[model samples]
Target chain A: MYGPSIDRLITALRVMPGIGAKSAQRIALQLLERNRDGAAELAASLIDAVDKVGNCSSCRTLCEGERCTICSDSRRSAQQLCIVETPADLFAIEQAGGYSGHYFVLMGHLSPIDGIGPEEIGLPILEAKLASGEVDELILATNLTVEGETTAHYISSRARAAGVAVSRIAHGVPLGGELEYIDSNTLSLAMQSRKVI
Target chain B: MYGPSIDRLITALRVMPGIGAKSAQRIALQLLERNRDGAAELAASLIDAVDKVGNCSSCRTLCEGERCTICSDSRRSAQQLCIVETPADLFAIEQAGGYSGHYFVLMGHLSPIDGIGPEEIGLPILEAKLASGEVDELILATNLTVEGETTAHYISSRARAAGVAVSRIAHGVPLGGELEYIDSNTLSLAMQSRKVI
Candidate 1:
């Protein structure tokens, strides 16, 4: 370590996901050695983000203002609401295109063992939105993992009780994925959900 | 992107060595979604480093004050000067736990094509330190690439003129590297530099 400030920067960098000791050191040194001005700008940006960005008042996705971009955009379909586990998943869905519906980010999936219940993942906000009668359909776009499935099921039941149609995103072979490499469960699901050409 | 602050943070994160668009987005979203306090602390640390850390007056390595810890330490051998390309390389050598000598970081190698000449890499400072007669042995620990070799040769000639003995670190099979997986040039060097075991 060069000094206390450099060491502190390295230590602070480890709070980021996937950054270990070696990576933290490399980043710290790179920031210090290459572009001090860029480093200062990055620091300012980080602080600004930490201060300004927060949960969207409407859909719970990250936003600088009261509503997220998707929630505020008049072009996006409010009747078909897509529920995702995280903002990263929402970004992935947006990048894929073709989905013009607004999204409600759960921030995390339910984990009963860890005491993360329906309320913990912002299920109440979703239920209240569903009950408002504005959204006609709820598209559960949570991940394929066990926790994601449980969360999807819980939300589906709530939507159904509120007279809103519920649909889970398909689970099968990924696009361009070879059949041989596909897992048995996914192959089975793909077979069960075979559609007309 | 959620907002201007979020986008700015992502752009700033892209300045990091290997972070790309997706990685920057992931990092920004993670920072916004959770651990805002940690992100704020990282920002503070980065600004502190940018404001305080500078080149050591004697060795040109990163430091908070005039001289770095290594240059100020009286216990380390002043007669043996190990020249390296960067502080990261210096850290690697220190972690290896064998050499206990002073170091002079060039910060970069000499590349006339890129307009980075001897003076650009602080050769004048190095020459002045060598001419002082404090150092008897000059250890060239630059990398094994073409530029590194060229820089080492140039430094060796200068050190020789100043009556300081010059030596390049041995190039061969790495300590934990398997011969089969290593490059052909390294294999050739390993064979050429084979010593009595």
Candidate 2:
């Protein structure tokens, strides 16, 4: 119903994660009618980022340089390496402002049905990092999902065999979570892992 | 927390309507991580559309040439001109498959508070078209807002002065809307504008 360029733009907008036909149409019309400058800036930024950004060589996180800022930072402990499923997870931990350690991004967990295995997730690079003797403590910050647990277990064993201590991040009720509303599985985990406070 | 290019891309993604900081980050990361080719295509499309698309000279709707397809089509009746608020509204009317007349896009309604006058909405062009003696009827398909009513009244007065019959699109309960759920203003309008069976 729209001109060729506008139609093409609406179709192209559907490539984003959650955008569907109606949303794509709204977005395309909004950009064309209201904010041409913003649209141009978005286009330039997309081109710039896509052309420049790549995985950090050391940690496999998205970055423009050879190493991510976290990987290159000298103050963060090299003795401890936190394993996460994605760059977004790495960002969440950084935003929480708790850990002051290096990180290794797995990008995804082991999902054999989808053909994602250890090697697919760059586990050999992680093994090499473990064998490097620089990391003494391997922190499992991957999610508590089944695939996450499986990947963590696989990596923990490899790290232990390489003489590195391994620890999994706690899984239970969140800090402000009410026990009554918490799921049974989480409540069970919390009860079983009760600490002597 | 991210590299320069990635950070720029995230910030740029916020220009999109309804995209917040978190959504922007997710979109940027998803594009960079999962579909670089899609990202590149979106960028190319945005640039192409922005560079080529312009307002149709006759209707002021978005198009790549001198006139929009509706304006250029000889089959559409030039005697019945529809005045709409935006190209999106024009597209909506066309999609409904009822109107087969030329359109004049106001782009916006008359808003003195926002300093938008008739001239700002290209009323001079509309006046010239009304004076051309070709259009016998003027259809006001603007929104049901107060501003839209004011603009429609203003244009209707001008059409009357130029000896053109004027009509406003009906205002009342939607086709499938129940009377119980309908707003009082719309219900009152529906009551006043009732057609005898």
Candidate 3:
């Protein structure tokens, strides 16, 4: 019902995660609420973000430059490396706090049937980062999903072949999660992962 | 963690309708992706829209100028007025097409808990518009929600003594909706709205 420019902007925004028709309408209304300048600014920012913050050539984390801040920081422990499937996963871990080591962003998980392989998802870059012999411990912090597990297994083999210690993050009931709402799989995992104090 | 200014932008965008934590992060990232220009443009547009678009003095529809375009245009049917809850609703009606009449935007519904009353929400202005003698009929197009119905009844009773013909939009099955999937209330409405051959 709006002009094509407005429609295109709505369509472009809808491509993002969780946005549906009603939500898209709200966004379009918001842009209109801001008027021409607001619409233009949002449009410009979206295009700019799409072009600018890409995978770092080194650790593969998102960066504005060729090298991410983690890769650029010389004081960060090169001997400790945390590996993740995507930049988003790295961001999630960073938000959880106390991660001082460098990171290797795989850019994706290994979904072989979907044609997403180790080579396709920055695994080559990860291998090179490991091959430098600077990393003593490579932490496999991928998601608990099947794809994430497969990615971890692949990376663990690669890292261990290079004689580096590999460790997986604990998988169990999430913090503050109630037992009543917990699924069978997670409940079992929690029982299996029980620690002796 | 980044600068508080960036954090503020993320918080500000998070309050936006339909934007989730991830989308808010994406919006914030885009702001950084475009640097100062993006922030400046966003801020400028936000301030401008807030400052510029206000209710038309005559009719309550949103306007960038002293009066809305529909109010200013002599060609529009002043005798027929459509009432809606928000400027966003006006856009929705406009997109539905074929209704070329003036509009009154209530901006908010009759929420007693919110302490909203007639004078506070531009009902006096609506009464004046209706009493101007140029208007022939008043269209009650407020939403079907409880608050919307209350507001519609309030507006209807106010204009009843003035001899204005008021009618609601057809209550029936929404276009493209399956009868089996629709609620009983909607199905009943569809039955009641049956037409002659």
Candidate 4:
């Protein structure tokens, strides 16, 4: 039970994911008591990001300007496009490295129950890109969940119709995965998708 | 990863308590994609709180003005003063309710190894308040650790010299506490400090 400004700050802080009442209160107290200047700077940065950042027009990835960094980089292969569900997934791929290709972020997967269908995930833009004959191979790097599989299958059909080859990211044991710790489904997939050594 | 603005936003968010790199990135993405308006409002609120909020001149509690609401309220009992180590503890006491006395926040406790001494906890301010003859009883509500005990002992001696009666908050089993689950030290204290009905 602090003053009005403190109450307002706690309320505002709760908007961030994973922050609850106690956490919001603790963070608010710390900001007010210890790091006022740093808090002010963080606030300014948040506002600046909100005002300046938007979805990249070319690939739907987040960017400060019209085109995202990956989309603007000419070194990335236009013929190899990676499809993903969200911006976080796109960033995760980038962090892993070695994938020097363009990305077409769906922004979300095809979830019909949530009223998110093909158009909702920006399928028209992807189809247009495919029809332009720029992308020869589409890499479906969506998550391995049921929804992701369904979305990937739908996009694959669309890519086939547009005369583009499509490939899904492999599903099996992770690089450091142990068979004992791996889930039964993953172990089965690893067994079923065995490759010639 | 994302864009320059997004990167900056993530870095700024990590300054908040408990947020790590992955959580910061996730929150940044969510803000840009889902709640841009809310993010903007939070930013504005953070700036407003940082620019306006300061310590109460009388009691060292956080406030938006010269005095905190509790210190400014005229109805509270000036004869009974509660001494606390931090504003968080004061707030905790208020949340528990029933206490309606003036407060003198230490802002910290005596930790010599950490370079904190009696002066660091504003002993002079507390001594001045006691000598003013406004306070008849001084309640020590510091934590239960070794530092809290040392601080309380130091303050008790000063308060005795100033002709003010001193009392400490009780250390016993918490309400709704199971006797079997209580720590041995707490059980011993409860046994040693048994009260008459």
- Name the candidate that leads on DockQ: 1
Query: For each candidate, what's the DockQ?
Result: 0.84, 0.83, 0.14, 0.80
List runs of model 4 lying over 4 Å from the truth.
B195-197
Q: Model 4 clash pairs?
A: none
Lowest summed-lDDT stretch of 10 residues in model 1 chain B? Answer: B1-10
Q: Please, what are the lDDT tens digits per residue for candidate 2 over residues A96-169?
A: 99799999999899999999999989999999998889998999999998999999999988988999999999
TM-score of 4: 0.94
Candidate 2, residue A154: the lDDT equals: 93
The i-RMS of candidate 2 is 0.7
Candidate 3 lDDT over A84-174, as tens digits, reads 8766677788789898899887766899899988787787877787788888999989989999999899889988998889999988988
- Give the range of the ten consecutive residues with the poorest summed lDDT in model 1 chain A: A1-10
How much is the lDDT of residue B1 in candidate 1?
55
In candidate 4 chain A, what residue range of length 10 has the lowest lDDT sum?
A32-41
Model 1 in CAPRI terms: which quality? Answer: high
Docking class of 3: incorrect
The 10-residue segment of model 4 chain B with minimum total lDDT is: B1-10
DockQ score, prediction 1: 0.84
Which docking class does model 2 fall in? Answer: high
Stretches of candidate 3 exceeding 4 Å from the true structure:
A34-52, A175-180, A190-197, B2-12, B20-23, B26-79, B87-134, B144-163, B167-197
User: How are the candidates ranked when ordered by DockQ, highest leading?
Assistant: 1, 2, 4, 3
